[model samples]
Target: MKIGELANRSGLTPSRIRFYERIGLLKAVDRKANGYRSYPAEAVTILGLIALAQGAGFSLDEIRALLPADLEHWEHDALAGALTRKVADIETLQARLARSKAHLLHVIDEIEARPDDIDCATNARRVLTRLLGEDAEMPVASLRAKQF
Candidate 1:
């Protein structure tokens, strides 16, 4: 098939297909006498795999490393290792994000729990003291000047 047909089948733009070819993600194409790029039937499947891998958070370089020049000779061990590492990286990111979310929620709770009589500066100081240690003394004037 031609480049247009391949792009249509793969659900990618012509520019994207060309980009993949330039970046060495897609293998070289055969050119017809009229200078039209010719692609094999397997090109559509490869493009779909590239799109899927990108959606799964794999970078183009990472995808390139995962895929071989010849689709028939895939490196199973390397692919498995890359998948394991990506999962571990995602888990670590999730843990960090959870911690950040918890900290934000705690801060929100502290702000909401402030007494009616307490001023904004005093509440800010109290919240800051709770977040940081009691040893960290921030001036009420500075706290009042800053927005949340």
Candidate 2:
């Protein structure tokens, strides 16, 4: 099929497909006598795999290294190792995100726990102190005057 038909079948824009070709992610396509790009039926499957890898956070360079021009020649051990490493990276990111979420919730709890009798400025100062620690170099008085 031609580039347009390939793009339509693959659910990617023609320019994107051309960009992939330029970046060496997609192998060189055959050209017809009329100078139109010719793509094999397997191109659609390859494009789908590329999209899946990108959605899973693999960079184009990584995908290029992981995927061979011909799927039949894929190295099973290398592919498995790369997938395992990606899973570990994702797990580490999840842990960091969890910590960030917990810290945000702690900050919210501290800010919301202010006594009703305390003024906003004093409450802000108290929250800032708890957040920054008592020995923080930044002045709490100035921070309290600024809106959150």
Top TM-score: which candidate number? 2
lDDT of 2 by residue, 1-148 (tens): 8899998899999999999988988884897888889888888988999999999988988899998769789989989999999999999989978987997898889989999999989998898777777444566687555433
lDDT of each: 0.87, 0.86
Per-candidate TM-scores read: 0.82, 0.86
lDDT by residue for model 1 (1-148), tens? 9988898899999999999998999995888999889998989988989999988889999999998887888999999999999899899989978987887899999999999999989999898888767545767686555433
Going through the candidates in order, what is the number of backbone clashes in each? 0, 0
The residue pairs found clashing in candidate 2 are none
Cα displacement (angstroms), candidate 1, residue 107, comes to 1.5
Which 10-residue span in candidate 1 carries the lowest summed lDDT?
139-148
By lDDT, who's the top model here? 1
Quickly count the clashes in candidate 2: 0
